[model samples]
Target: METKKYPIIVEQFHFDMVDPKTDTNQNVQVAMRQVEPSDPARKDELKSGNMFEIMVPFDVIPPQAGFRVSGKITRVVQTLDYFGQANEISPDDLEKLSRPLIEYIETLTYQVTAVALDKGYQLEFEASGNQKDNQ
Candidate 1:
């Protein structure tokens, strides 16, 4: 059988919350955007309509959230494809893509923790929240 493999990119990864432990009392959203592909030698690479969004309930946030937020986007490529068509993704493909997305989520979690820790010693602050933007 003939075969063609296209790239699959994660356009957007949205999460309702990052902290499952405390999400019951709050709301959260995480969004990721994918840009059009580029070629080093080409001055003008296509740049439009290559974005998507995903949303999940706050409760779904993992107990340990970090650079690798479970269910967050993996990677954004050209078209979501594996050994066959885009519609039929293999388990291996899924696993391969998941690693990076998970890493990104884990990283975000650490950033939030660091900020929270930094302010813990302050005496005048009654309450403080940390907003993290991770890679």
Candidate 2:
């Protein structure tokens, strides 16, 4: 299958080199983004199931950093008013009635952590809460 590239800025990064040479512990900075599927075929996949996936660079922790990222975006029914009522919409049911316009997943808040890089490679990384953006 033909694939195109998209941008993915690492929102959170945490690395501890027990053995940076071979350990992947210091390399996985997977970030999740919520987006609407661009292709019709791709949209079908997400509609089939409310489940989604996380795309990763094929090389994974390459000599150079920053790679393209993409993933499936499934509908997530979130309550606008938590204390108002309990009438929540199930993801399955939402896809069933995909009408004139499809309801996309609405994301409010995100906790992104970013690590400083030294020429395409991670220099120093620290873990923090979802409160503020990491640098």
Q: What is the C-alpha lDDT of each candidate?
A: 0.33, 0.26
Give per-residue CA lDDT, model 2, range 1-135, as digits (tens): 111223322332232222224422222122223344667676654443232222221112222233221222222222222212212334343323221111111011111113222322322322221111112
Poorly placed runs, candidate 1 (over 4 Å): 1-74, 79-83, 118-135
TM-score of 1: 0.35
Predicted model with the maximum lDDT: 1
Cα RMSD for candidates in order: 12.2, 15.7
Compute each candidate's TM-score over C-alphas: 0.35, 0.20
> Residue by residue across 30-68, what tens digits does model 1's lDDT show?
333344446655323323122222222221233333212
- Which ten contiguous residues of candidate 1 have the minimum total lDDT? 119-128
Q: Which candidate leads in TM-score? A: 1
Model 2 bad stretches (over 4 Å): 1-33, 48-122, 129-135
